[model samples]
Target: MRPQQGMIPWGPNTTAGGRAGTQGGEGAVELVMVNPTEQAAIPRGGNSLQSQPDGKGHFGGVHGGRFVAETLMPLILELEAAYAKAKADPAFQAELAYYLKDYVGRPSPLWFARRMTEKLGGAKIYLKREELNHTGSHKLNNVMGQILLARRMGRTRIVAETGAGQHGVATATVCALFGLKCVIYMGATDVERQKPNVFRMRLLGAEVVPVTSGAGTLKDAMNDAMRDWVANVADTYMLIGTVAGPHPYPAMVRDFQSVIGEETKAQMQAAEGRLPDVVVAAIGGGSNAMGIFYPFLDDSSVRLIGVEAAGHGLDSGKTAASIERGRPGVLHGNRTYLLQNADGQIEEAHSISAGLDYPGVGPEHSWLHDIGRAEYVGITDGEALEAFTFCTEMEGIIPALESAHAIAHTVKIAPTLPKDALIAVSLSGRGDKDIFTVAEHLGVTL
Candidate 1:
């Protein structure tokens, strides 16, 4: 079923097609979706961006569609069809749920940040501990879901891209479990910097290819992965790492990761007896943030905040703060906010954290920002570094640097809120892979 803005879109219409609406049980099937209230308000030269696609598979309104070469377009279309069929099948959902519980460790805790809350002294903070997942990051949520769909499509191999190496490791881990041949394209720079994760992927029986063009980060790596998928279209499955890319991918990845928000909603009600006052996560290609933000879109009382990477500072001309600083543009096969210049050429993004160093974000986030359903902000490397230290020392949680960005923003806003106010942070990944970078930044040897 198309994930709409509701507590549970899995009612009567979830199968065969979602009801007109899942909750209200009215409307057409909108997979890359939005509630009626959600639509693109941002005008481009006087026209509004298409925010919601109907049954025709318009994807993410005007912001997302298949924007690839004709040869690759057919592959994307086939994947979309396969996914729709799989979602409608009871067996597919059953098996996916079973593996999520038995293998990838679902229902990640929404633990109250007792120490951090007391330390902040204002808002109560709860962490959706996605870091505790088997692969140590939220990336596996998407990888596993896509791989299952890939298998059903009769695809025999998997190809993916990674930046900080967390995704690469996660993809490789799952590939080995299913005995699928896996190839992960990573930036040459990332392969060198995130060595632990690189070694982990290699040990998991996946081939890692390093791309050297562009700034040697996620975007470059994605380009290479897309190329590989096109060249080997018949047998290869391109497992996109995040909620970016085109059409069904952003929608597909968001649905897979939505489990984070799904669990958080139940856990928050169970923990605090009500919904959180605010939900926060860092946005790179925006999957983690989307996972946590999607469920709460219709809750007017709850604030959804996305923190982007501000490499040095927003004004430093070296930031990955796309939603905050970018204008409308197309990149990586979908139209979305992008770091571009006067001539509309894509600019390289800079962030100390490899995972957050992308020039574009998931298209749904772009739509959300335009519609004012969510807020986007920027956190700098220095601030994120300090936040990383805070979580490590104060809470004994050495968060992934990308998660540190959200933590940094949390401390800034949480302390300013009322004492009873609540904030839920998606601690999206663990810090083991980031230890080397953190140590080097601190001028210390590990």
Candidate 2:
């Protein structure tokens, strides 16, 4: 990686790691999918479906391509074209901006946690208050945008998958606003734990389907949603909640959720007079991280940090530290880094935070990690819980378990940094939903 003007790239010794195939296998490439019922060769015309040139030679790769069966081809193509048109339209951009500001509440504050920072004794820690957004999380940001796009494309039904039920609630809320039918697939365990969100989605007139396959978690929910899509692709639009999906979903989700970065930039300038020395966010499927990291991509002065959930610890195979334990593979419509066995069977990831128990990350995250544009770290479940407790006690802020991962890093690094150095963390959501779970973990009986 070529060193930018004043930026200090972290991770590997040298930034540049060579081309696309540098780390992967060599010689002629071929993709074949074999199943119990069918076998076919995956099209390998492109190096990667996601790796298209973005004119600037910055490598705008599309990780997932449209690989649906022939029955859904026409509908998928139509939606793709509509997205292309929306991407090129200025009016669409303005409309989204208006909604973000007036409806969803844009420009969320970059709050300097004075009490917490003083207690930590190091860096000036700031919180990007995404938890204050409508529906109580950053998930609403992408849901609103996608539901709008779905409406524009004349789709009458929306389908989505959720891990902790936050995304399902957000998607259901948007569908209610647009008067479209919404169906969300959620894991049985999550539904049991996040009953409030499940109830909220139903109250919003959306159907909440509990998936029982496999471990009955995010991956199973995703598989159920995909099966639903393959069955009802004609009238349904799948509103993916993360930046890890195939093709346009990852790119589209990132673009919609990027308001976090946009707001952080402006708020930091007004509050601190400059960019932050570090921007930290928790990465599940990488949506929140991308949202907070996108604006800082070209801001060479800012350091990007992504925190992944280390269920027990990175050394523990039970952890959800994808960047730490995963390898490049295709899952849920994209070829990215996934935590799987040698035979490609997905592993069950454990995290105290249901939202952070994902086995794979976004392709852009994988690319950014490889290119050394961002640094991915892990925080153990105990550390995250400690951070959650610390923040609540010191700052009166109860962060979601997932967001606590970022707070954990801030706690570790804040005490060591100079007073002038600033840190911004994306508080992805509120912790009201996790109170019971935390209590259970802490052995505090309600």
Candidate 3:
């Protein structure tokens, strides 16, 4: 039976293959993924960069391409063409830019965490307060971009998957703005934990689908949404919440989200007259991290660090440290590192933070890790809780549970880095959505 309206629950004993099985066992399904090397050939005459598959060969290099099942190829091709045209049109870009800056509140503050920095006794910490955005998370950035693209493509409906429901809220909000029909699929567990956001999505006029498959997390919701897209591809555009997934999405999300770093660079330069010594962000599907890191990819002198939730501990079976425990494999339309068993069956990634719990990182992140351009690290649930509380106390800021992973690193590394060095961390979202969960963790009530 389909889950009831509002929120649902998922557990370790649950499975996501209910619908996916009828279509095909998600079993070892492989799709050709593009690598960066192949991207060079795409711009041959510069007829536009859409022709090349992202780095591996699926669509656009590094990011951009198709990853749907064969049944959805016609719709995928139509979307590909629409996106391609919209990308090249100046009017579309300008219109979207206006909404980004005005409607969704782009160029969010680059705040200096003076109190927190002083207490840590190390590097100065600056925060990209994406939490200030309209929907209270960096997810708004991508949703706005995708929904606009959908409008330009003449698409009338949108679909998405959410874990903590922040992305679902964002997508629903944009759909309301554009007067498009919206549907969101969410894990039952996530729905129960993030009730407020679920209500918010409903208030915005979206149909919320409670996903009952898998452990009822982000992946399960994604599977359900993908099935919907396959069935309704002609009129629906799947607004993926993160920078993971197949080709075009990873690249497309990064492009829309790059505004974070773009604003950060200008703000830091004006405030400090120089670039930061380091950039830090928590990684799930890697959209936030990639948004901040992609622009800095060419900056060899700056250090880039990505934090993943360590849940209980990496030493235990319960952890979401994909970089530490995962191996290279393919899942969800891309070839990248994934947390999987010996037979390549994806494993459940553990994290106390619902938003950070995922079994895979973005393909570009996999490449970044392979080339050593970025350092990936993990922080335990205990450490994250400490940092979460510390930030609220010292800085008077309530950070998202996921962002606490990066904050936890500051707790450990701040004392070690030079006091004069500058560090910028992506505070990806606000804490209102997490208040209930954190309250329960702290033995309190709202």
Candidate 4:
């Protein structure tokens, strides 16, 4: 029997909702009615969560489709093909691995936070130290991979959009390493707040362009970068900073950033003899969270929690909790949950951390949320600030404002769990870039 328009088939006698499925023998057939929206959270063939977005980049048949202009269609297709080819090539893999290890610094440590655990007095906490990587953030993983792909495609110039400027700095650093022209589009507001990173980009020979449109934030910068790419299609590549763009980009960026999750898995096994009970990471465009969550998708025992920036409070008009307060909409060439008004117009998102100040989230995150494969929560700016101070004082590790959001959520839940429970938080970046912002918020003269 054909299921309803919004419904799908599930295994017999199983729960009727979520992307739940069971492995079956060859030619085995069983059907139970389920809402299509809730189906396929875990892929069917072998229950592997990684087997997603078959071909067209749509996660769970709802989010993520190529919604770009005709002028960019051919280029998008070319990029999709190039990425697929490169992903399968052993030579490409070896080269990327070499650069990641020798230059970008792979296998960042997973430190057990003894003080944090003692303070919480509940779950044992582990910090995935991506902040120690070159450029001081996980952004370098995607940037390095994309820049290498750009070179393979014979592109001599690279364009990127950044919010907190970590991505811009990473892109600029790689461009300088490879002698390619680099151009970064950052929001005017971000340019002012992240002046140090802006200077670093310029020093590395990148042209930093301040985008003044649309609240002067990451969304505006992305808009400008897309325009630049459309105009300079030839000899230019757009290295999207996060996994929130058109086809291949969301998937491609996730694959590159997956290194974090992959390494964390191995490290956790070696340290604790098993997978973590929960994984936590902050979500701006959700690259870091997706990176760590992707590897654990199949591990049903591990809970994945994504913390979105709640600028003021979740109910406050000023906030960046897209998944918590958004509806599905197409933005920046992909269909995802966006903070929009009743008229379907995108709303301005506010966050103390510039990196999380975007109106939409990656489509995969939306799909995961719908399928109940992951859980997302909001951390208010005040909560994050408190966590920041606590982490610095207790652990002596100053985390980036983006990572502070995750820490805030961890702080909330750690005390409630059992002592043996383990939680791993992705310390995505260092706090050096955010000291000024923190000081200003604390009413201190820096």
Candidate 5:
């Protein structure tokens, strides 16, 4: 069968060594999925999606790269080298593992949502309980890894950007644990809406700086953090919260967050004796989605779905569904799908969930979308809110608004699939930080 536009033409039974034909004669490489025990057996340069970007950071031949100011090149290069060294060192791995298991509470449970599954009445639903992490989100996974790397590099100060404040909170928590100075740049709007998280950051000894530029959201916060990094390259390490940045960051953060996927794979096998039928996650900068999607990339039988926040609707000119309604463009240092206009001006994205309010998605996600390795869909704010309430009532779980987007999509598709279909959704964070925002939307004053 011919491949559809923007999708790779690989059949379900395609093996690891299979080559898929793409449009315009661009050859596509198929990824090989391996069992957890055999992961080390795969060759370093094999045809796996995990070993992507080809040393230049460009995924699928085009989606990622270091498009940063020349001033930051030295620092970026230094970070890349340090991270590479740390990755290869067993000592660094052991340190990071200790912190993750003891402090951050990793290997979060894979919960079977019996109530939600019965309510949906089709697919069996399993929620990857990232919310159970110490910082109340999967943000801790990446933050812990980066903070340890920063310590290894002898950086005494750490800077970061946040939208929903989960990343900010997680970064601050780690910095506090290590006694490093922390500075979090948050959009003014986010700072206002996510006051609880802002307070949490402050309590954790992080100085929160509010950026008032560009709709006062994640993109603006990232811009300010990058500026701060450029000015203080001597002692400051920029702890990026997501997977949308330059070369080493996109790959580095993915490596750190891949633990989520790895755990899910093993846990799913233990629970069901096989891989899950579908893996679902919400996409903001696409970290959580990438974290959960990376391990299963080569498993042709397992479907990967990423749900983007559609603030109003896909066509309403105000949505964060970058992969769905956007074109490829450069933003936040990487070439990816962005919500831009006719003149290529970056458009402000809209979403009730601050985390998913960015105008661009991760470059890896763009590559995956182009190659049909995964599917992305948009969930409107209303739908997410509904799911938020439904999940709370049905599963007794309060999912962060960001994760509610994934749950909303699951609510839609679960009923359509067969009863035995297994679906795993990344509950990336708790709803505690989103209570104020949700209250206001529901016309309740708290």
Candidate 6:
């Protein structure tokens, strides 16, 4: 692979391997028979009718209610109330916009990938350049909003879990911005693979705690963070990075992230004079996809496609293709689709992309998939790597491996469309952090 700025071939691998994919949510379609029939479980073009989650955190009879120990319930209740108030407060909204503009750099570009579009020979492709955001990637969008709420709740410390380290870095960035004590729990394996990000967090004055339990992956990191939150509920705010935790969290995070789609809608119409034919994003825990897909849900004409990580292949027993092959199960405090074995135990998820390596997806995503509001497909590691290379060479952009999954899928379908069609891919993050991973994948030492 060719080199780009901030990339050099002089050291051992310092970043996790390239991502397989990342993980997504719900609405207007319905909230009742999750999988009424076996045929409806995987619909063709989301054509099948189905039921889904209720307002009380139960999707299609799948409960997303809290299952935490009693000690944390009071704080959870308090958090729920605080969030409600904050959501309705004008002051909170104003502050959030101000930071998004002046600090996190809002209004990320929606650029037409002319070269890539021309190469594809059919659809006009747009890159929602979220990688250009201040802290790099869409993670900062949620981090800033959550930190603002944390400050409003009088919390003195911030705690979060991270997989590929982007969210951890973004959380650390906001904590430093707010002058709050920050503690980040990262899997020990992630810490090693993401050494640069670990140093970056420490450089920003956040403690990077290496979690050793389990496989020391993203799931294990989350477990450790939850334990920490319970131990210090009064003083610490558990800043969940994705839309998977519990009630209010999935909805809350989606609201904060909706900015991506909100911007995309206005920007696309302004640029193309019409809505795009399709909008696609990578899913790990489903934040970026939800952000981009939520605003377009009511627009029945616009297609929403979410790409998942098929680490090896769907039949390999090592992929993270939850919606495509997983069963409905509870994980990480929410009931959602998860990869599990016959014994009902959650299986380890594999993805070259650290961010997409989770056993389950957000509950709302489960609802969406069931109701046919959106469609999901899997992209393998090699395919994502190829897309990563193509984007850099063709569009002069190096995307995060997580984001590459979306691009990998986009390229496949875009070329088959008419020239009048438009396809937009959320360039979720920069790939500077994934150089080592790519090097490893290519049998090269950085």
Best by lDDT: 4
Clashing pairs in 5: none
**Model 6 lDDT on a 0 to 1 scale:** 0.80
TM-score per prediction, in order, is: 0.89, 0.86, 0.86, 0.91, 0.92, 0.87
Q: Candidate 4 on 190-298: residue-level lDDT in tens? A: 9999999999999999999999997899999999999999999988999999989998888889878887887777777767777899999999999999899987887
TM-score of 2: 0.86
Q: Backbone clash tally for model 4?
A: 1
Q: Pick the candidate with the highest TM-score.
A: 5
Candidates in order have lDDT scores of 0.81, 0.77, 0.76, 0.86, 0.85, 0.80
Flag clash pairs in model 4: 19-41
Q: How far is candidate 5 from the true structure (C-alpha RMSD, Å)?
A: 6.4
Better of 5 and 6 by TM-score: 5
Off by over 4 Å in 6: 1-55, 60-63
Which digits, one per residue and each the tens of the lDDT, describe model 1 over residues 1-446? Answer: 12233332212211222211112212222212222111112111211222143343333344556678888988888887898777656677677777777888886888788899999899999999999999999998888888889889988899999999888898998899889999999999999898888899999999999999887888999999999998999899999989888778887788788778767776777676778999999999999998888767656798999999999999899999988888878888888889999899999999999999999999788767766778999999999999999999888898999999999999999889998898999999988888888898999997
Query: How accurate locally is residue 346 in candidate 6, as Cα lDDT from 0 to 100?
Result: 86
> Whose lDDT is higher: candidate 2's or candidate 4's?
4
Model 5 C-alpha lDDT versus the unseen true structure: 0.85
Candidate 6, poorest ten consecutive residues by summed lDDT? 15-24
Off by over 4 Å in 2: 1-76
- List per-candidate RMSD values in Å: 7.4, 11.1, 12.0, 7.8, 6.4, 12.2
lDDT of 5 by residue, 248-357 (tens): 89888887888888778777777777789999999999999998888788778999999999899999998999999999988878899999998999999999999999
